[model samples]
Target: MSNFATPETRFLIGATGSIAVTRLPEYLGALRTAFGGSYTVLMTHTATNFLSPHAVGLSAERVIAREAPEDWPTDKPSRLAADHDIVLVLPATANVLSAAAAGAAPNRLTTVLLATERPVLFFPHMGTAMWRNPAVRRNVAQLREDGRIVVDPVEHADRDVVTGVVATHPALREPDGVVTAVRPALAAS
Candidate 1:
């Protein structure tokens, strides 16, 4: 038996195009400090544009971000979903939100969202108006109905002379010092 408790959190960090991408290091650092021994991070291609896979690798034991067809599983839906404890989408773009809600998997990130059996957490980041758009609202409503956890977005003044919202997860809340040892249960509250 080991003296240290291994956390069961296998986090798939999906990123879409959003200004919040600059904050990923803070999030990863918090997870590392809290979980210590159990945390995996996977990134989306769009996300890699903002941060390097090498940087992400510093926090996670393994980092995956390939779009090659051969990289996908032989199974119809792929098997990455089967291997993770949870899928978290940070700085989720309006486009990705629409894709996930519409069941369209155009890339690895969306594909994982479509296939994962565990809890899916989405942190939407976009302009306030886009966040409130009817289509986006409907998609968000549908995702929630489908049992996905939609972390509330934080509002901030944007350089574009508008308000922007960035979705946040518990790992971004505060350092808990305890690894999230299992897939978090979905809570409506």
Candidate 2:
């Protein structure tokens, strides 16, 4: 067990982009089981297409979606930041990575990121080609330089439906793996 695996630890889960967002329930359940901590979920507009806020709420103390500012549980991003111990951007899309690297607050999730002094962990998920893109590589480097923990996505074999050809792609780490990474990521920072 990790030293940080305490009941009082608070986790802010920022869900971004597609596919991997569908596994949020599993992720939340794993975190709750591993750390016995409270969880709050913040979703990007695109995340809504993958999973509903109510689904996320089933495992979280609070759920905030970017499109529905009226449903925000906190008055400001800084307040939310102050309340949480760490920020985990799961399924971090290239868009959010670029935005964070540039210090742009174009959305609610990014706004909270900008306000938080907490350790930020990014678990990036994208195609192999996109993950290897020059701009994406630069953004990841910038985020690391800025003191954020960016976990490299694991390689997974993905099959193309049309061609029936298998290709290795950058995939989100399993929930347990992510929970395990958090400790070292925090310790390093």
Candidate 3:
């Protein structure tokens, strides 16, 4: 395998179901602008609920929404794994994190997450309560112990659209912060 030390590092984005998914276009744009690398997105079924597949396709070189192995390119995970330098799970939902920690591959995204030899980085997003759940904390610990890069969620005050009640949530970091974390991962990879 070729070293991904150049500016041409490739990224495989494993997008999950999270309200934070609404920021994908901007996040993808920032990643491209900062690294000038190729990006391919693998979307979960739930992800479609928040954003259209077409929207993700517009920002990535390829967008794969298939769950079945036959739906993927030839040789499946090997081909996809070899095509990227890193696997990024942006807006990683608690469910996905637990599955990953348990080494479950129920879907295409988790399949790649399990198969990839490249570094896997997770950016978690959820309410503060869920983020602080004991089970969730244990899962996050397991992921880190297994050598995955799990970015801690930044606290953000989100105001309810209808009630105007502002409450703090564990949110995805700013695009620049994400890029900062990715840079070192790329270098180490």
Which candidate gets the maximum TM-score versus the true structure?
Answer: 3
RMSD of each: 5.6, 1.8, 2.7
Model 1 per-residue lDDT tens digits across residues 1-189: 122324555566676766666676677676556444444556667778888878877766667766766855532235777766666676678888799988998877788888888777777777667878899899989888887867656544434335454443222222231124222432211
TM-score of 1: 0.75
User: Which wins on TM-score, candidate 2 or candidate 3?
Assistant: 3
What would the per-residue lDDT of candidate 3 be over residues 64-150, giving only the tens digit for each residue? Answer: 876665776652776788888899999899999999999998887887788888899999999888999999999999999999999
For model 2, residues 1-189, the per-residue Cα lDDT tens digits are 466556778889999985889999998888788777788899998999999999899989989885566746654687888998889999799999999999999988899899999899999999988999999999999999998989999998988899999998899999888888887754553
Location of the lowest summed lDDT over 10 successive residues in candidate 2: 66-75
Residue 45 C-alpha lDDT in model 2: 87
For each predicted model, how many residue pairs clash, with residues at least 3 apart or on different chains? Answer: 1, 0, 0
**Candidate 3 positional error at 173, Å:** 0.2
Candidate numbers, best TM-score first, in rank order: 3, 2, 1
lDDT of candidate model 1 versus the reference: 0.64
CA deviation > 4 Å runs, candidate 1:
1-6, 73-77, 158-189
